[model samples]
Target: MNDKMNLYYLKQLLNKKHVMLVYAIVKMSVYICFVLFVFFSLFSIDFRDMQLSQSLIFATEEINNSSSLLPGVSLGYKIYDTCSSTTMGVRVAMALINGNENSALNEQCTKPAQVLAIIGETQSSVSMTIAKTLAEMVKHFGWTWVGALRRDDDYGNSGMAAFTEAAEQLGICLEYSMSYFRTYSQEKVLRIIQQIKSSTSRVIVAFVTHLDFEILLDVFYEHNITGYQWVGTESWISDSTVARLDKHKILQGAIGLAIPNTTVTGLKEFILDINPLKSTGSTIFTEFWEALFKCKYTVQNDSEDTTVCTGKEKLSETDNEYTDMTLMPFFCNVYKGVYAVAHTLHDLLGCNFGTDVSVNSFRCYGEEVYFDKNGDPVAKYEIINLQTVEDHHEFVMVGIYDSSFPAHNRLSVKMASVPVSVCSESCPPGTRKAVQKGKPICCFDCIPCAEGEISNMTDSIKCEQCYQDFWSNPHRNECVKKEIEFLSYDETMGILLTAVSITGTFITIIIAIIFFRYKNTPIVKANNSELSFLLLFSLALCFLCSLTFIGRPSEWSCVLRHTVFGITFVLCISCVLGKTIVVLMAFRATLPGSNVMKWFGPPQQRLSVLAFTFIQVFICVLWLTTSPPFPFKNLNYYKEKIILECQLGSAVGFWAVLGYIGLLALLCFVLAFLARKLPDKFNEAKFITFSMLIFCAVWITFIPAYVSSPGKFTVAVEIFAILASSFGLLSCIFLPKFYIIIMKPEKNTKKQLMSKVPVK
Candidate 1:
């Protein structure tokens, strides 16, 4: 009896199923006759809720209401919810491609549907998966240097992997890759925010759905992290909910790829006119109405907190989500997707509308809908910036990313409308980059170029060295010609020294004239008038040689000055030494048994002077032939100026010349000191001793001053010493003799010379 009842129930159930199957076929055939073209749209309706679904419905209504595209034909669409899952998205895409909503694993579209194109799987991972299954159609939109933020699921991971691979092949750099979950922990969201804040990339390509990004934005708002240039996919790029977030300032100046939005005339009025009573089939609209009015629609199980709707609530006055057109990127994508299918069908069907030839391309609104070789719509994305208009933050049309343009010029961003974020400030000109340790390439220290080097650009890696004849300016930005410096006659010190040298020469000449005029005078004759004349001539030469040290040095002057000065001074000192010996021998000859006077007579005295002077001449000759002083440009003394001076080529040879002169002077000084108390009027021994003392003192001081001095001062010190010593020699030896000869005629007599003789 139970088997008989089961068979009757099964027969009745089968009969009802057959009737329903026939009804479904009859309904599908009737709908297919009216549908001129069909396109499928995949969205994350479960995760993103009503917003994603509403975007497609509103876009379909806009296309259906428009009379411009497919004048007589109607457009139809089928949408599937992926629940923000890549696997679901793939299944939905494959089902649409195979024209079988129930087919889970169909490789080919055996039962091909009339669908022309697939609009989207809003999430990046879902879209990437669909695109990969659809023959890598993502390459149609070229993007480089993008930061990826993906969901921490199979959808996000696989999508990010595909994008990363394709980006690498296209030479695109992934600045950062972060992951988030649908039900993310606060710690994870905070960590993602911190990573975004620390990343140097300004363009963040978010591969998450609307809800995932909303959570991230909430964390970003809490931390006050902003100025991230978000390159959004279709998911949240056009999501009106993100614009309605409490802190929308975080998204200001963000740029993203968007479906070019067109004015769907009366779409706002259509959305505003919607009510739960009028839209009986739209359960999402009823939910939207309740959320908008903060009221309940049903009275069956009403709670104390649930307010009953008056049915008079205005969507314009309420917290509505679909009023603004700036947040309608997804709506435009669906609208274009419908038109893309209509245009493809219109071309494939050979539909003639006022033309003999059928149109292969169709312009829907302002966009030209055409399919590429891969059967995907020609990728045309609008670059939208999240800008503030009045008090409302919304997407502003800033630029376009057209696939038709060249790769470099494809994405045209309005830099003025975009905000920049970087790890470090740009290093200004005149500074070079010093990379910070343990920091990103963008984070670096600005260091000024080193001495003699320059950096003319911002963030230069290394400073360039200036040319040999050039130097860096104060700012180290450029090279400037070095100042040509030399010991010239126009300088103040040079003029003063030149005047002093001329004066000393004049004084020496005057003394020479005085000694010559009084040649026969007893005082003059007593000092040996010939030796005095020769000494005066040598002193005049010494004063004139100092003039060389006052002017610009040259190769000729460098060699001339040192050699002439050395030889002349030696001649003068030799004359003094000759006089000292003459004085010693003259007094000793008066001692009756002194044979020393015979050994050194007037001829021998001349011979001794020549021999002593010849030694200095030999030393100077060796100095000139071996390593003579030459003009040198000294750059190390001062940074800005060159010291044009003579370089003493051989230190030993130069000192040898001075040492020889000193030896002669020291010997003369010692011999003169021994005979300083000679019992004779107008004794020349005291004058020689004093002159040698002054000469030694001047030279001793010159050594330190010369060594310590820099640039032209070194030359000045040597010249001053030469003039002082020469003057000392001329004054000490001849002044007293001139006093007696010119002023005291009686003292100049030979009797006066013998008056000071000591009685033994």
Candidate 2:
């Protein structure tokens, strides 16, 4: 029973065999279409993504910041005494120099010097002298410790030895030691200047008694040697005469020294506090310290009002702001110096100090210096170009100087971060940055190859030179290659067709002789009229150079190549068409005047071919000169190279090329479809039609590709397209036909077809 049922199923399948085959073919075509769609879509998406990422990443990495951080705790202090009496000069002098020396030395040393605290001139010349000496010593030694002081000595060295001896008694070896001289005569001051100028050590310690600082200032300004840093002691301060000397320009770069109180705000408050009592007739400590340090007004208090002040005073006092001899606040540069060091240390060690404002003092357990023993900071110093807002005064401060500024209301500080190095040369060509600010030779970036150039080794340290026909810039970062140009269809394939025509004519002549010699034979007498016309037509079109390449031609020849190429292509197609028609008609000629035979009869068929060729020629000539065909004037950017190309006029022109090819493809497709029903003997039409379809497809797609290609390669692209078209025609259409007919004549006809005798 199973055998009978299987036989019945086989019979039914056999009946629908044609339908099954069609269904299978349709399904396979659908699968192919889907696969092509997905493949192209993915390719396009990836290409777009690659292009976008290139621009964004390149733009973002060029400029970056590297600023350091501020320290957490209040590291140091500045003290200023503003009393305009005997000590004012000393106070002002000390304010400029004291902590500044240590700051400068810290900059040069291989380590940062962090001075945590500072106490200043007891608002006096005597105190300023001591402060100045201490600052010089710190500078000389490159000490990094925080320093504090009791006061200065316009009270003279009367107090220095006592203070030192007292500190010594307490087992505190003075960290710093210094000296000074005091004089008053102009001759003495000039002699002192001369003496210092002549001395081997070249040191100036101004501690003159009763001599104004202006005389010394005038002498120094007149002498102005480059490297002198004039540091003064107590007696140098309280003199009123120096204030009259123009400090802005004369004492501009001079360095002074003084002890500064811990807090600027505190000192300001103290000034304010003293301001209220100035009119009260109340004796304050400010008044006492001023007189004592300035060498004026000895105290007679015994015990009266002793809570506010203690000490002897100077008898000389002046009211002139410029000439006041009162011991005033020594405005300390140490305020910024100390703070700067603390902040720098914190940054170097990556430490946070603390956040409280009132907490007056700070210390580090094992303060790590960001330097070696050379007193040079390990970190780089940023050279600042600072200008004062009030006076437009300008100066440079290396490293951090947020708080420790000299007098004249100028402090050197800015928000910009210190750069590690000012400016280094951009990396040499051929290498790219492996990482930013990284040392070269290690972590270096690679130079990419330029266009029209390629490197075999992708890891090449330097880009290789481009091959012949190519060149790149100095860095070899880009490349350009010599372009290939086809010029036009006439230049290349036209010559090729001419050669093919000569060869084909020779073959045709040989074949004709052979046919005549064997005239009695039926196969020989059977004329291949289609091949004859094709050979003749192709030969005429190919040899007619009158119209093709000759630049200056009569209107006839001008009209000639256009018609010739059109005729040649048409004849080429019609030859194949005629051959197919001939074969079909020969088999079906028994039926009278068949459509193939009638439509393609010798004279009518030739005329038809001529008509079609002329129509194409007319259309081509008209289109070639119109805006759609010849839009752009060829521009010559290079001296040697010239290009001839058809530019699309507009969107309409762009679509015109596409539309023309589409029509040709449709015609070839229709012919191939109709010819498919024909018997195998006439199947040559199928091959010819398929070849035309391939040619049309290549050019139709090529139009867009050529148009969109960059100018550098657009001409090359057109050349490639022409080459591909010619090569395809020669190989696919002509090569196979010649292979069988000329190379192997035995396969030209079947034995049965040849043996069948014609009935006369």
In terms of lDDT, the best-performing candidate is: 1
> How well does model 1 score by local distance difference test?
0.68
lDDT of 1 by residue, 322-413 (tens): 45554455545544545555554445334323333233466655656665655555566665666778888777777676666776676565
> Candidate 1 deviates by what RMSD?
11.3
- TM per candidate: 0.68, 0.32
Q: Model 1 off-target regions past 4 Å?
A: 1-79, 91-178, 186-241, 245-391, 398-422, 483-486, 591-615, 635-641, 650-652, 700-709, 738-746
How does residue 302 of candidate 1 score in lDDT? 50
How many clashes show up per model?
Answer: 0, 61
lDDT of 1 at 52: 42
Root-mean-square deviation (CA) per prediction: 11.3, 34.7
What lDDT score is found at residue 735 in candidate 1? 82
User: Which parts of model 2 have CA positions greater than 4 angstroms off?
Assistant: 1-588, 592-599, 628-645, 650-665, 680-683, 696-709, 712-721, 747-760
